[model samples]
Target: MTLKFLVLSSLALLTNAHMAAFHKAMYCFNGTASGQVNYNNDDPVSPLWMLKKSDYWFHHVNQCDDFPPAPGDFLELPAGSSFTVEVAANRGVTSLSFNGQFATDWGDGGNHPNDYSVANLAGAPLSSSGCIGNPNMHTQNQSMAAGTAFAISYQSDISQVTMDNLAVFTVRYNTPWKRVTSYDVPKDMPACPADGCTCAWVWIPNGCGEPNIYMQGFKCMVTGATSTTPIATPKPPVWCEEDQSTCTQGAKQILIWNQAEGNNIAVSGFDLSGNPKSPAYNSKCGFQDGEGFHALVAIGNVVSDTSPQEHRMTSLVHRPLPPQRLQQLLHHPHLLPPRPHQLLDRLHQLWRHRLLHHPHHLLHHLLHHLLHHT
Candidate 1:
C-alpha cells in the first residue's frame, strides 16, 4: 500500500507540473464550482506531445466533441466583438470564482492548491526576456510569444471538421500570456449553418523550447454576423518573416508542426538572421483580419487565372523560396551571374517540376555552374 501510494502521488505531481488549458472550453463541461471542477479529471489534457505524434496533440483527442453540450451552451462569437476566456494551469484555480472569490494568490502554497499561474508558472518574475520562467508554457517574450488563433468550420459536427475547411478568422498575438485572454471576432465574418459551427483555439510557440503545438475545440456560433459571404478555403501558412510581400495571402490553415503526420508546413532551418523562421498565427505569417481572395484583390493584387493548372503554376512561380534556401543564396550572392533574376526563375521552374530531389545537391549544382561557367 505504501509503494502504490508513492507512485500515484508522483503521477499526480507530474500532471500538475505542466498543466495549462482554457478552463471554460467545451471539453471542461464536467467542471463546476460545487462539484469536481476539473472536467479533464486526472487524465491531464495539457501535457506536451514533444516530437512524437499522438491524437492528444490536437483537440485533446476530441474529448470536447464527445461531451456535447445542450442547445445554447455553445460559445458565442459576436461578429465585430470580442470574447474572453480564463486560461490556467488547472481548472481548480479557475473554479475558485464559483464561490464568489478569485484566485489571486501565487506561489507553491497558495489558496488554490496544486495550481500554477498560466502565464508565469514559477510564481515569480522571470530573469530573462525570452521563454519566461517555465519552458513548457513558452510565455517568456511578451512581444514575440507565439500568437493564438480562432478558426471556424461551418460543420456543426466536430468529426466533420478538417484542416482544409477550418478557416482562421482572427489571431491574438503574444497571447497565452495572461490568465484572462481576449480574442477578437472579425467584423466581416458570416453566420454559421443552422446547427452552428465547430471552432478551435490553435497555438504554436515561437521557439523557446520543444516545438509542440496546441489545438482545443469548442462548439461556437456567430451571434451578430453582418456579412453573407462565406470564408474562403484555408491554405497552409508560409515562413515569410524576411519579406511580408511574399507572404501567402487569404485565409490560412492552423499550423501543424513537429508532428509525424498531418504537418502542413516543414521548416527545418534558420532565417537570414539565424533566427528560426517559425510559422505562427500572426500577421507576419500571412494571417490578417478579413482575409480572403476578394480581400487580396481589393488590395490590388488581382489574381486572374484561365485554368486550374494556370492558377497552380502562377502561385508556384510567384511563391518565394523556402527560408533555408533563400538564406543560403543570400549568404553566397557572389556565386550568381550578372542577371540573377533569370537564374532564380529557372530555380523556381525546377522547384515547380520537382526536379530538385535534394535541396543541398541542387544548391551545389547551381553554385558549381555559376562558378565555372559564369
Candidate 2:
C-alpha cells in the first residue's frame, strides 16, 4: 500500500456532504520554553519564527493542495533541538508528508494515523510525535543529522477544505537570558525602615542566574496582629509612588501605582542619556524596550486587612526557580525568625519562599481580591 492509496481510500469513505461540512485544518507547534524562541502568535497572517537571529518558519497559506513550502524551505534546527506537530481538522487529518515522502501503512484507510486523533493535535506534547511507520514500522528518514532543515505537512479529508484557526509554534533555547539584579523603586520612596511600617524583601529568579528584580520594603500592618487578610491601597486611582520618577539609563527603575481593580507597575526604559524615560500617563508607563517583566508583586499586609498597603513591583521575569527547590528550602531547620542584624536578609528569604511556592494561584487570588473589593 502507498500513501496515495491510503489517502484515496480514506476519501472514498467520506460522503460529499461530510466533505463540504468541514473545511479547515489547524497546524501549530507547542513546547517552546519561555523566551527561548519567538513566534508571532498574535498575527494569524504572516506568522514568523526565529531562533536567535535566524529565521525558521516563514511561508504563505494558500489552498491545501499547494500551501506548504518546499522541503528545502522548511525550518532548520541544530542537533538536539526538537518540535512536535499539532493537527486539528473539522473532519479529520487524512494525509501526512515528511520530506516529500508519503507514509502508506497508517492502518486501514489512514483513519487515525498512529492512534493520533483530533484531541492529540489540540493537546500537542512538548516533544516530537516521532515519525510515522511504514510496513516495517520505520520512517523514510532513518537518521537526522545536526544543522538540518526538514518539511512537515498534513492534509485534511475532503470535508476540511478551509484553513482557519491553524498555527505553528517552535521553541528553541539557543541562547540564555542575561541576569538582572534589583530594580530601584522611585527615588523618594522610603527604604526599609520607616515610621509605623514593617518591611520585607523578595527576589525572583530570572533564569539568567541573577535576581530578576529585588522588591524591598512592603508597608507593614498597623494593627490586628493575628489576621491573615491582605492589605490594599485606600482605593483605586491611588498612585503607589508619591511622585513619578525615572532612573538613569541601565538603571532598573519601576513605578507601581494602584488602579480600581489592581495595582500596575511599569518598568521604565532608558533614553540615549541613560536616564529613565517617564510615561506621559501613569497607566501607559511600561518597559520601553517592549520586553515584559515578571516578578511576584505583594502589597499590603499579608496578615490582615486595614494594614497600610505597601506596593511591590514584580512580574514578567522569565525562567523562575523550580518548585521542588522551594519546597525543600521551606523544610530547612535554619528557616526562622530574622535577627536584628539579619532582618533584611530574612525578609528577602521570606519573599522568595512565598513567591516560588505560589507563583500562579497566589497572584491570581491577590489580583481578584483587589479587583473585587474595589
Candidate 3:
C-alpha cells in the first residue's frame, strides 16, 4: 500500500496551537553494515528520520520530505500563527540541523554555550535598529562541485514559535541555554569560527576517514551556507547532533558516526554538485580562485564546552594512526625508570636470557629521549 501525507502550515507556524496535523506518512530505517537505514518518523510539518550508523556516511536522511535546507522543505504559514517544538534524546545525541545550516542562536550573547542567550525572541526589546543576527554564506560556484547541499547538523533545543502577522524563522536551538536580554550577532546573523575548520581529532578518534568530512565541509563552503538557515538547525542541541555553529561560512563541523569509527567518515556522493571542496582546510572561509572543486583528508576542530575552552584559537590536528601503533607509544621500556646506568643492566639481561631484543627499538628510543630530555 502507498502512504500519503497532509500539511497545515499554521500547525507549525503557531508558537502553541490547538490545531491537529493533517496526516503524514511514517518512515523507518533499520539495517546492518554494508547497507543503509533512513527512516522517516510520522510528522507532516516537520518529520523525523532515524539514520543507522551506516547511513551517517551517506545522504540517506535527505530522502525524507522533512529534511531542511532543501527548497520547499518549509511551508510558509499564514501570518499570525503559533507552534511549539520538542526534542528528546534517547541514545547518545548525534547531530542537529536547521534549514540546512549548523544550528545557532543570536539569543546567546551572539556566541554559543560560552554565552547566555535568552530564549525570548518575542521580547528582544523591539527597536528600529532591526534584528541583530543576519546570517549569510560566501561559498562560490567553484568550491563544492557547484550545487551540493551540506547538512546543518548541530546541537538543537526545541523552540516555541510566536509571531505577530509576520513570518519568523528560527535558525537554531539550545537545551540548557539560559534566557538572556540581548545577543550580539542578532537573530538573523549567522555565527561561525572566523577561520580554519578541521575535525581531525574528533573524527579520527571516532574512526572517521577523511573522505566524508572533506566532502561535506566543502559542500557547505561552496554553497555559502549559513549556520542555521532559519529552517534547518536540528533541534534539541546535542553533541555531534546538528547545531548552528558549524556549516556556516568560516564555521567548523566534525561528525562522529555513533562513536563506532569506520562506520562513517566517508562521503557516498561523487557528483558533489559542481565545485567540490578543495583538499585540506583552506585558510579562507571558502574556495579560492583557480582551486576549483576539490576534496581531501583534512581535519579540524571548533571550540566546544570541553577541551580548549579558553583557547578559541586552538584547533585539533590529527592523522589516521593504527591502535597498535598508539599502543606502542604507551608501552616503552625506557619509560620504566632512569637509574643512570640502567641501560647496561638491561642489555646484559637481554643477551643473558636469550631474549635479546634490540637496544634500538624505535619505541624505546622515543621513550628514552623523552625520559632523559624532559
**Top candidate, metric lDDT:** 1
lDDT of each: 0.58, 0.23, 0.22
TM-score of each: 0.63, 0.17, 0.20
lDDT tens digits by residue: candidate 3, 105-219: 3211122233211233333221122211111011111121111111222112001111110111211111112111111111222232232111100111111112222111110
Candidate 3 — number of clashing residue pairs?
78
Q: How many clashes (backbone N, Cα, C below 3 Å) per candidate?
A: 1, 18, 78
RMSD of each: 12.2, 23.9, 21.4
Q: State the lDDT of candidate 1 residue by residue for 217-250, as single tens digits.
A: 6778888877665666778888777688887666
Question: Which regions of candidate 2 fall more than 4 Å away from where they truly are?
Answer: 1-56, 60-374
